[model samples]
Target: MNVAVSNNTTQPAPRVIKHRAWGRFKRNKMAVVGLVIMVALILLALFAPLIATHDPAEQDLLQRLKPPSKEHWFGTDDLGRDLFSRVLYGARVSLSVGIFSVLFNVIIGVIVGSIAGYYGGKTDSILMRFVDMMLAFPQFFLLIAVVTLFKPSLFNIIVVFVVFGWMGKSRLLRGQIMSVKNREYVDAARTIGMSDFRIIFVHILPNAIAPVIVSATLQMGGMILSESTLSFLGLGIQPPFASWGNILQSAQNLTVMTKAPWVPIIPGFMIFLTIMCFNFIGDGLRNAFDSR
Candidate 1:
């Protein structure tokens, strides 16, 4: 009877990785806006076939050079293709190139960087020097040079982008891993006789991956721009395929630039919008991951 009643209090649950990251991300207003716009663009691209009123590649010489109107929301291009439909389809190409190229670049970079960083001395020296050698080349020049050597198709262009893009990310993750490899948890894992692979992949990478995530997000816009640049130069995503860059290729003509300004403006704005949104989201992720 004298034992008295015990107090009952609920403990707060731990925050999830995604929830925590999202909480931090939403704090940035510009990032939230960027996320919204990015999602909308992605959806627009995904549903282009259904949303598009006309065939993106179908040409009608009679409708060519028409300005924005009820019949054609973005009007018609020089080929008399519906600009609105082409723009939507272009989003799929540009976005896919950006995403796939960046993904492969990050995977290769992370693997190379992790191996070099975890196993130091000669391994680090050789790998870091190789990265430096790759970096010494002017990236754009190198990109153009390599791209010119291959067939100008979507797959070839992505492969070329991946080849050049990994160097920076490798250097970034290598530095991050070096900083993190000596931490106490890593030492603890080592003390327990954990395999080198597990220690690096499981213990070390989770902590070091923040910078890589930020780097990858920031690089997306650049990747998209690079793809666009190549397409503009006729070195990527050949004709009949809609891409923001190839769409803008029309503006190279003075007549088209003067008479059908919408041809370039629409794609140009799309590129600008996509890049800014990616940058905003990158900044948000950087802030979100920053514990300070």
Candidate 2:
């Protein structure tokens, strides 16, 4: 130390940030529970083929409307397909739609918001006005209208969701960027002759992304619920594809509602459980990112 030795023990900034965030997240009990449930659900979905006892789509007239049993854990659906298998397979579809839709939504939102925020005046005004117009529209009705224009499928559902969902995220990021773009580091990047795109994407986004991450996590739950709604309405994932929504659609029948109530209850509870988990996780992340 007397010979002017350099200290190399300090953690890097990114590592420090990740560690702090994880540490804070771990302290939140509800968040940890949500994380555990979500991880289990994802694993089940991923290994559906190996874990599922019967074919999701296999139809047997005689076995229809049976309650939970040793052979069929969740019981048979109206069509006699195993509810357990269908739920597992449906997880794949529902989770994929939610994840992909949010991913694309966030990507588009970040780009749009960064441009609008980094370059103020005319650029910001025009982009923000467009966002406002989008916000004025009734989002649910818009989603229904657009989804109806295309055939109902997984890819199509995600596409329609992304198209409608990005506006809110863009608005959130725009505000964050506007607040942070004038920071010393951003100014430092600009003074060094960095390209506008690089400065915005590399320097500005990393700092401004906390809110977006929280928003995206919360939005995923809504995305899954919306997909389920569309499927129930017969405008999302079609028959033969086991979605939680489509499974609940059977409850619309008076006979099924009274006779095979578990069919609807299983998927309904799953949807509720997943949404609650996402909400808890979002709350944890929001608290973790709060500097105060």
How do the residues 132-229 of candidate 1 rate in per-residue lDDT, one tens digit apiece?
99888898988888889877888888888898889888888998999988866677668769999999998778777878888888899999999999
Q: Which stretches of candidate 1 lie over 4 Å from their true place?
A: 1-18
The global Cα lDDT (0 to 1) of model 1 is 0.87
The residue pairs that clash in candidate 1, if any, are none
Per candidate, the number of residue pairs that clash is 0, 0
Name the TM-score of candidate 1.
0.91
Q: What does candidate 2 score on TM?
A: 0.93
lDDT of 2 by residue, 45-69 (tens): 9999999999898999999899999
Q: Cα deviation in Å at residue 74, candidate 2? A: 0.2
Give stretches of model 2 more than 4 Å off.
1-12
What 10-residue stretch in candidate 2 is worst by lDDT?
A: 2-11
